[model samples]
Target: MKGNETPRSTLWYFVVAHTFWKNVEVESFLSEYRFTIVIFPTMLKIYRGANGKYTLYDDGISLDYLQGDSVQTLIKWDDVAKKLSLEPASKQTATRTFQVELIPDGVTKRIQYSGRPVELKF
Candidate 1:
């Protein structure tokens, strides 16, 4: 990540017009996730179907880094982000981690938890 790039941590929110809910086409309320690079100016997201299957959304992120069940499989997150070079300082394997969370019913429709990349090493 660029040294000058101050990490931006903001929630990705969705505000339903309420009318959209009344529309017949609105058969359901969908579950979605937003993924942000935290430090880098990158954000990624995915959706969870009623069937529990996941569909990815393109938020200007390369499919390679967050291409898999990265959010669900948070164990190797550091490695994945590094592979994507989202963190230029990631040369040191297993160095840092980007925390991810999926929040539902949060005051608004939004991806939960946004902030600077916090290092959590056991």
Candidate 2:
């Protein structure tokens, strides 16, 4: 995404999911979908910044979705099950973010993400 591109200017929704893992080296599947991390989970509680960015407290690791060429790409899930699989493991504790375009007439109705402004068409 371009620096000049105001994220809120476009019609989009943010999806957040989280889970915990005992001893798994999970590669956060972020770039596959378009989303900037507002917070990431760690051994303890999740630490979120005032600006909606996230980081792992103890580990000092931050989740950045806008650093690479794959940041603007969209991911396709075959079905609801597939989408659920993408969610962070609920048992442990992790946070994942996803950006979805709003389609007013789609069968799966679109809902606005909190704090995001909505654009109305006349």
Q: Write the per-residue lDDT of candidate 2 for residues 9-121, one digit (tens) a residue.
A: 21222322322111122222235357453332211111121112122122124443334212221122323121211221112332323222222322222223222222212
TM-score of 2: 0.17
Give the poorly placed runs of model 1, Cα more than 4 Å off: 1-46, 50-92, 103-122
Q: What RMSD, rounded to one decimal, does every model reach?
A: 16.8, 17.5
- TM-score of each candidate? 0.17, 0.17
Q: Give the CA lDDT, 0 to 100, for residue 114 in model 2.
A: 24
The collision pairs in model 2 are: 18-94, 19-89, 19-93, 19-94, 20-92, 20-93
Q: Score each candidate by Cα lDDT.
A: 0.25, 0.24
* Residues 3-82, model 1: lDDT tens digits: 43434334453312210111011111223453323232223221211212121122223554454322221221232222
Q: For model 2, what is the C-alpha lDDT against the true structure?
A: 0.24
